[model samples]
Target: MVDYATARMNMVESQLRTNKVTDQRVLEAFETIPRERFVPDHLRSLAYVDEDLRLKDDRYLVEPMVQARLMDVADIRAEDVVLVVGAGSGYACAILATIAATVVGLESDPELAKLAESALQEQGVDNAVVIQGEMNKGYPKQGPYDVILLNGAVAEVPKALTDQLSPKGGRLATVVRSDSGPGKGTVFERWEKAVGRRTLFDANTPVLPGFHKQPGFVF
Candidate 1:
């Protein structure tokens, strides 16, 4: 059996801390959340590895380094309401719940959504809820979130999701993949009348489903 606690500590010290993930809260959340429970039984041992854990279909629980960096960039506050797209089995939601006041995890896969909800509830993550929905559309019922996190990479940030930002300085963090270059871990913050973007680091997370760029018609 894998010593999950030791694995979490090793991941925190080796993967996250060494990579500049300095936020104490973010680090503690990663260490506290039972990452193995969020993955399939066969993948449980690999949960603390420094790579994305594929859940089902194209879904993944992003690597610890990437998720930590993004959470640090998001700078989630205790009073903030967060929305996590492609929430998969709810690892990200559980992490966010540690910092944010409320969390909404949107997942398109019914099975994954159920798994997320069940796992979160089992873990007593009462402030977070998992809901089934189109990943790209986002859950508008709890609109204008203080923070938005995409659980995987995307060719481009969807307008639908951006439109859900709090507008009062809400921030969205994700890995933006490029065809010509490496994917960039980026943060987009809503500014007065506009949204500004900044790249924090290079990331290569697998693109979440429905986020690929649509092909254009040939002339």
Candidate 2:
């Protein structure tokens, strides 16, 4: 049997620490959560590896290090309400549940939403509510959330999602494309009623389908 506990420890020490995920709470959440359970049965053994795990369709579960870094940038708090766009299989939701007071996981794919609901229930994570909806719209009824996490890379940050953030509250961390290249991850924070966005790191992952930029006619 693969030792999940040992693997979790190694993941923290080797993958997260080396990549600058220095938050203690973030590290603890990553250490305790069983990432293997979130992946497909055939790919369970590869869970702890430092690579993005592809799902049934084009969606992907971001790598552990990437997630940890995103979580660190968000600075999740116990009293915070979180909105997770593109919940995937609920791995990121599960992790956020450990640190945030409440979480609303929105997944556009019905199949993935069902899977995520089942997985979260199996893990006894009651703090998170899973819903099937449009990723760009976000879960507005649950706003104003303290944090919003985008599960996959997007070319642009949707206005609807950012509108749900609490006033002078938290941040939104996501992998956004840059004009310079294909896959670039950017972190955006909302403070003092103004939004500040910046590129944090480079990540090559499949972009979420609906978030792609619309084409325009060439002159």
Candidate 3:
């Protein structure tokens, strides 16, 4: 059996700390959350590896370095309510729960959503909830979120998702990957009626389903 506790520590010290993930809360969350429980039985031993772990239906738990960076940049506070888009297996949600006031995990895959909920509950993560929904459409019922995290790369940040950001310093973070190029870590911030965007770093993450660019009509 893999020494999962040691593996988690190694991931934080090597994968996260070495890569500029300096937020103490974020580091502790990665260390404490049982990543092994979020993956399939056969793949649990590989949970703390420095790569995105594949979940059911082509979904993925975003790699730890990228995830920690996103969380650090978002500056999640104890009173913030966060929305996690494409929250496969709920790893991110569980992590966010420790830092934020509440976390809403939106997953498009029904089975994955169920799995995430079960895993979260088993871990006693009471500050988070997993809900099934369309990934492109931000869950409007929980509008005006303090922080929104896209669990994977997208060709573009849809306005619908951005619209949910609280117009008072709310921020949304994600990796934006265009066709035939590398992905960029991006954050969108809202203030009153204005939204600003900035790129943080480069990543080569897998694009989530429903986020691909639409094909134009061929001549």
Candidate 4:
């Protein structure tokens, strides 16, 4: 029998801590949440691995390291409301719920949303709610959010989502990548009428359902 509890601890120390995921609150969040519960039972044995776990609906649970890095970069505060796009299975939402005042997990797949909501309920995650809808559109009804984390990578973040950030200090973190090169974790902060961005780390998270880059003109 796999001791999932011990596996979770090892993941925190080796995959997370070794990767410079230093925020104690974030670390504790990862430590307490049982990642296995959020994944399909067949894949649960590999839950603690340092890679993305395949989920239904063509989405994936962003790898543990990438997820941790994004959480650390977002700097979610205790009183902040957050929004997670492509929240697959609710693992990211569950983790963010541990730190944020409220987390709205928006998933485009109804099946995945059900799984996420059920998992969160089983785990007693009260601060977060999973809703099924379009990933690119974002759940505007719950806006504006203090922090927005995309659980998957994107070729380019939609402007509509950027507009959903809570004014002033609201930030969004995601892995931006292209078919031509490696992905990099980037954080975007809304400032009045502008959004400032900076790279956080080199990473490659699975791309969200509708975030693919449109092709450019070719010869």
Q: How do these models rank on TM-score, best leading?
A: 1, 3, 4, 2
lDDT of 2 by residue, 1-219 (tens): 889899999999999999988889999999998999898898888899998899887999899988888889888889999999999999999999999999999999999999899999999999998999899998889888899999888888888888888768568988886556657667777775678887778787567769887787999
Better candidate by lDDT, 2 or 3: 3
For model 4, residues 9-84, the per-residue Cα lDDT tens digits are 9999999999988899999999999999999999999999988888875688888999999999888899999999
lDDT of 3: 0.93
**lDDT digits (tens) for residues 176-217 of candidate 1:** 997768899999999656999999999989999999988989
The Cα local distance difference test for each model comes to 0.93, 0.87, 0.93, 0.91
Overall local distance difference test of candidate 2: 0.87
lDDT of 3 by residue, 2-64 (tens): 898999999999999999888899999999999999989989988988888888667887889
Model 3: residues >4 Å from true position, as ranges?
none
Candidate 3 local Cα displacement, residue 95, angstroms: 0.2
TM-score of each: 0.98, 0.95, 0.98, 0.97
- For every candidate, C-alpha RMSD to the true structure in Å: 0.8, 1.5, 0.9, 1.1
Model 2: how far is 196 from its true place, Å? 1.3
